[model samples]
Target chain A: MTSAAQLTQAQDRFIAVWGQMAGAWGVSRTMAEVHALLYITGEPLCTDDVMERLQISRGNASMSLRALLDWAIIERAHKRGDRKEYFHAEQDVWTLFRAIVRQRITREVDPLLASLYEIRDMTAIDRKRARSDNEDLRERIDIHNQRLESMLEFFQTLEQLAAMFISPAGKGLQAAATLLSKSPREEAAP
Target chain B: MTSAAQLTQAQDRFIAVWGQMAGAWGVSRTMAEVHALLYITGEPLCTDDVMERLQISRGNASMSLRALLDWAIIERAHKRGDRKEYFHAEQDVWTLFRAIVRQRITREVDPLLASLYEIRDMTAIDRKRARSDNEDLRERIDIHNQRLESMLEFFQTLEQLAAMFISPAGKGLQAAATLLSKSPREEAAP
Candidate 1:
């Protein structure tokens, strides 16, 4: 039988690694650590369990769990005959990825796209109302507009691509893997 | 003709927006602001220019510029008979996107893939060396290994997709756009 110490070491390493990775991807370290703990145990953990295990304060544990719930990557659970609430992470890796991607697209991409469109329209209106005599100013504004349009186009394309991947009819993760596998071989030929 | 006041207002707004967007994508606010300034102006800017325009300290400006240079999204330039160093952001949108993607893949994804692989191997060795009678421990280790493998596979697929886009024959950004445009229609027909 493996000793308890060995298991603890492994779990600690996993949680540390996961927290670092998730932090880079915009999730806070505490939240990621809490999720990692739940993920490794594959069982519902009470707030106390999380706090004690991670050596974090009660407030930190509660806030972290709440943030994970906000991401929709964790859910509250209740055991039979238990009064305290517990939490469990979404176990499916693909589902977790989708949730994060969907959240980011909604929170970040959509608004940026709208703002770019507004900026472009406003610039166009300003250009039209201005006097036509200032060729130099007009030329500079045109270059700026062109750059903005190119950036807008790039973001639009990225958003559409993300939409396709997340849609029901889409093959989702497998589709990306398949494309990757096929394209390299095809491109290798003259 | 556009007044100096109008142009400054517009430039300020663009820098603010770009900085916000870039910060969300993992770049520092100062770095993004510096890049945005160079981008909108479409010219090389010295450290003094960036510091004065952004109202930031010299140290902050220098550090942000260094970070951008490390990402290779901006480059140093010099004018004839001038000793001061000036910097310019990559003007081509596609090239800029490619550089950011490539840098992230190297900095974040590649290291992550390596670490996952290492963890998986270590877990396997540990599981094998442990006493054979502990079925529960063995099962937990197996589950952990499975999770690691799944994550590794996902990252590997992503790396391949990135490679295809960066390849000369890949059509890179346009391929993603084309795929997005076609996939929805194809999926809808079913």
Candidate 2:
């Protein structure tokens, strides 16, 4: 096959893999495919380019591009004297990863933490109202409180870790990468 | 409301929140609800208990329980003179998190990494076979290779981090927690 054909084949495989794996990561397949197309080609692509290449509906391509913009992984690029608005993906992998994490945290983690806190506070009011003579009820409340606290603590830690990774200073991701790359013994050594 | 009634309400809310959040984390709603029910109640429950509490069909309950067991977050329990099998969730939050990461890595990350490797290998063969006179094709292939390598490196780093977190020596998780909890300045001090 020609080199151009080989290149197209590789790009197709990359897009296919990305689309397939997206569901496992809680992302839409089409959205990932759109992003993969932009990233793999390393070129500014308009809605027409996206629709034509992916064979997706115009509305679907537009929505995916809009969502990718909201996620901050892709941005609008302009060409002089051109009427069409083109989109470009953040080519730096670290930036892309951080942007995705930041988006997920905002969309998913924040609401989860809020719900956990709401539950805890709601239950706290109930815990205080229990009759003193009801030992069984009190014990059950304690257990419930403990379970909620455990979950809250775990999620809170995760939130902190995410914040560190995506902080503006940006040393956290590199530090974490270095630390995690070390063996157990190496990491453990003082 | 009575303390028992309040407890039930709390459990119900917890289950709902977990079920809703499960989709964001790529888990089934019913499966998360089943796990939440077992976990919040802190009791070894039979299939009957799960079915009645979740108001799900027997098949759904059985499937969710089986999946929870497969994820290693829940396990079978036996009671004296009881013919029915009971299931229990891992109560410790850290253990639960580790188990989940391990399961996701096996199911999602492992396959993703394999696909990436396959793509890289396949493209490498194509690159070698490309005609030397075609500079444009060579450059395109080079760009494709670079993109794949960057992604591979980032994911490989993530895999190592996950491995550290789930390693049996058990220091990795705690150490990472401590490291992440530190301010950037404090972490950089040593």
Candidate 3:
């Protein structure tokens, strides 16, 4: 376990780094730092643990955790002999990647498709520029739909692959890497 | 050019879908929609174009455009015919993927690692729980670091392969799929 002094200094460094990171990934600073805090803890931590250590509000901790849960990056800790329920990060790298893809698709792709559809129907005969812009939007709608279709197929295959392993335990990434390295042109062998 | 009817429907669909996708990717709804809008437009669009279409403020458009810029998904498109400085997405899919990976690394991995270091160094015995938890944090950190390293390397290789035309534009994915199918195990070719 990290000593308090060590922990604090480490946290300061972490927050600085995580803040920079959040901007690119499209997450808020506080949220990324909160997740960073949980990720570095050597053990599964509860809301109280996070709140006290990070000096955040009870509500803040709750909100961040729920958000993390939504991302599938952090898992509710399955601790032995503990009911308060701790939290841990997705330790397995491959699983983590899969989780991210699945969550991203659900949140970004599906919804964008819906919006594209809406923009296509808004019954406004504006100016030439406006009409042209609308055409562009429709193009995006088509491109994203096609892109997402492949992504969905990939995600579906991943889910099935994940289920295939007898033990849900993390496989060293080599197996998955090998799979990823394979040429895409080949379909599954019968 | 899209007619008023097509534009309205497209906008509605995009707006409806934007939220879920934004939530999933950790980006704001407005941000993703803005990107989607830029993406579909075959021509460079200025702030006004985005603002009027999305019914958002100039400030919002600026902020989000800056974000898209940082992510490298969209660029300032300067057309010789016009000085308004329109924006356009990087049509090259591989380039888009590379930019996203690079941005994510800077935004997430680098900063989170810094936080982990600081948190590791905090001194004082806050509690036995903190100590126990710290150890677990270390393991997770090590595992994550290794995984990220490998993943980054893989991305780097993908970029290289993409550049080398080992996988040609458009056909790169097909070539890769073919490569994967050729072997049950991805041993480096002799």
DockQ winner: 2
lDDT of 1 by residue, B50-110 (tens): 9999999999999999999998989999999999999999998777877887888887789
Q: What is the DockQ for all candidates, taken in turn?
A: 0.44, 0.62, 0.22
Distance from true position, residue B70, model 3, in Å? Answer: 4.9
Candidate 1, residues A88-136, lDDT tens digits: the string is 9888776677788778889888988887877776576556544678777
Q: Which portions of model 3 show Cα errors greater than 4 Å?
A: A1-4, A7-39, A44-47, A59-97, A110-190, B1-3, B15-31, B57-71, B75-83, B110-190
TM-score of 1: 0.89
For residue B100, give model 3's deviation from the true position in Å: 3.0
What is the alpha-carbon lDDT for the whole of candidate 1?
0.79
TM-score for candidate 2, residues paired by index: 0.93
Provide TM-scores for the models.
0.89, 0.93, 0.55
Better of 1 and 2 by DockQ: 2
How far in Å is the alpha carbon of B181 misplaced in model 1? 3.9
CAPRI-style docking class of model 2 based on DockQ: medium
Judged by DockQ cut-offs, the docking class of candidate 1 is: acceptable
- lDDT, candidate 2, A91-125, per-residue tens: 99989988988888998889999998988877887
Order of quality (lDDT): 2, 1, 3
> Cα deviation of A152 in candidate 3 (Å)?
9.4
